[model samples]
Target: MTRDGPDNPARPLAGTDLCALADLADPGSKGFRFRQERLMFAGFVVRVGDEVRGYVDSCPHAGWPLAAWDDRYLTREGDLILCGGHAALFRPLDGVCVAGPCADQRLSPWPVAVIDGRVVTT
Candidate 1:
């Protein structure tokens, strides 16, 4: 949610996680947190389909981090990243603002794609 785009060349994520992919077996499910942040990027890995995607943890609503508590990120059918403070729903695919207070505010996705069972965020 900064002044930069998804592919801002900031190396949004350093090392990737494949073991953590199991947490995302359900839709709208997410589990990730950076145990390390070398270049100012807290890596978060999510599983979508058979592929794993990564994004920065910060939510776009009020510059707060996503995940209400624990590893929970709203209900499975929620289909959006629910903000704990103001209840903003952010689309997972493109990180676009979908509903709630910040409907037009996107989650600022970190450019990531699956490559041979690896989730790379660059």
Candidate 2:
């Protein structure tokens, strides 16, 4: 048995090391999911230049994974996050819905950190 948050044995627990920051493409997004003892954590990380932000994978409007394709969470122009389920657009810098049915809503934030070139939960 294990608790939620950042202590679980899943791949996303606190101190758990994810891929290197360089593994993610700049100005792009990547999806990740992990489950342990029946608990699941699903999220994505967006990278732009030297900044990276993580958010729960679920969309505010439809409660579905934001990306229809694996690890493809950005718009065609790669400027904002796009919800494939409903075409909702969100600002990658803040995850605030800027257009579509769930306008004004925000994606749940996931604490993360970069240490020695790796991305880890905080």
Candidate 3:
């Protein structure tokens, strides 16, 4: 279900198997869009170690998704989430803007949890 907000408030995950926890490997990202009421909701998922995090997929610099063009949302080492469009880098822990042009800026975060080996919205 989609929560109404530029605020991107917490919303419960809908359906199942949006993706498996293991599916979000380094350099890989996933996107999901859900509809609720009259609103359309969108988010991106990133895998880090044994956990996963989700975000609105928007970069604070240009208000665009961080990936270059596809699911490649991270640097080669997979520690920093990169916005190839502007060379901005973000910390995975809280989607904090950490380097490049948008340093001190931040990406909007969406709540995520893992259940039954599947990544889910929380």
Best prediction by TM-score: 2
Candidate ordering by lDDT (highest first): 2, 3, 1
Per-model clash counts, in order, read: 0, 1, 0
Model 3 ranges with Cα > 4 A deviation: 1-17, 26-28, 35-40
Reference-based TM-score, model 2: 0.88
Models 1 onward score TM values of 0.65, 0.88, 0.77
**Where does candidate 2 clash, by residue pair?**
6-14
lDDT score for residue 114 of model 2: 84
lDDT of model 1, residue 10: 42
lDDT of 2 by residue, 26-122 (tens): 8888888888777777888998888899988888887888899999999988889999999999999899999999999998888787899998878
Model 3 deviation from native, Cα RMSD in Å: 3.6
**Model 1 poorest ten-residue lDDT run:** 34-43
Scored by lDDT, model 2 comes in at 0.84
The true-versus-predicted C-alpha distance at residue 51 of model 3, in Å, is 1.8
Candidate 1 residue-wise lDDT at 21: 40
The digit string of per-residue lDDT tens for model 3 on 1-119 reads 44435543343355445788777775467877666556566678887777688888677788765676667777888888898788888988688888888899877887778898988
C-alpha lDDT of candidate 1 relative to the true structure: 0.55
Candidate no. 1 TM-score:
0.65
